[model samples]
Target: MFRDEGYDNDTLEDEEEAIMSSAIPSKVDPLDFVYTNIPDTTHILKLDANCKHCKAKKIVSETDGFCCRNGQIELKQPEPIPELMRLWSSMDADSRHFRENIRFFNG
Candidate 1:
């Protein structure tokens, strides 16, 4: 038989307080240390021509292309893997490090 052990509201509140305290730092503005313009750094995509598969607009770069309507179509450049690997290998150590450490943040 299950016996009712009375629910402890005080204990529940204490646990919640403890969790909240640990979740946030009591420090100065954390936002001040972050680079605000980091999100604005982007690659400009050049539109190429109409898509061959769907006859929609084909926006492209040296590596790949995307169609306006045939977005699901894989438009990877011929021998993409080898080309990408070659590009990766050609980059300097610092450049490679920077690319590897790229992160996206949302507020």
Candidate 2:
């Protein structure tokens, strides 16, 4: 069951005031924070390739030419992602994490 109702104008205004008081100080100017064009921060992909299995929307091994996770298809490379990136990626979460290992990715 859901209560489909909205707060009155006064109640909403008081709630906003409370939130503003609890929040961090706001920027003095709209342009105080500067953003610049940057490269991809994290390329979090199970298998970053366009193999037959990947094209079919199925999770696959990152290495060994991006074949299906079934291990029936041929394997190309043992590891495509480097140690740093591999650790950052899910590394077959759909199969490993969902099936056997249970854990959450750290922020």
Candidate 3:
């Protein structure tokens, strides 16, 4: 069975207060942040040539040379992941310890 109608009113008020408190922080300044220029979807689309798909710029017909050639495109100069791994492995013990300390403090 439910409680009296008046008891539900008090319970609802308490729940609303708890939700509002959690939503806003104790210390916050509205003026601390400034709004920059609004986003322009049209300009962004123009900047990044839509060669990504078969619709932006077509070299041949409306179905061919849209994205690079066709099929899968190959990288001109592939990144050397192995060299990066070797460099990371060569880090001194003190540097590694400092990185771990920083991570712990941040977390």
Candidate 2, 31-107: lDDT as tens digits: 54554445558776574445554344434554554355644565465666574354446556554553343354431
Q: Model 2 TM-score?
A: 0.18
lDDT of each: 0.61, 0.54, 0.59
TM-score of each: 0.25, 0.18, 0.25
Given candidate 1, what's the lDDT at residue 74? 57
Candidate 3 lDDT over residue span 21-43, tens digit each: 99998698776565455555653
Q: Residue 87 lDDT in model 2?
A: 49
- Using lDDT as the yardstick, the better of models 1 and 2 is 1
Error of 3 at 60 (Å): 56
What does the lDDT read for residue 91 in candidate 3?
78
- RMSDs, each prediction? 19.0, 19.0, 16.0
Clashing pairs in 2: 64-76, 64-77
Tens-place lDDT per residue, model 1, 1-106, is 2334774777777878899999998785778668655775677778776665656654565223344334566545576576456545668775576457645211
| Model 1 alpha-carbon miss at residue 67, Å | 42
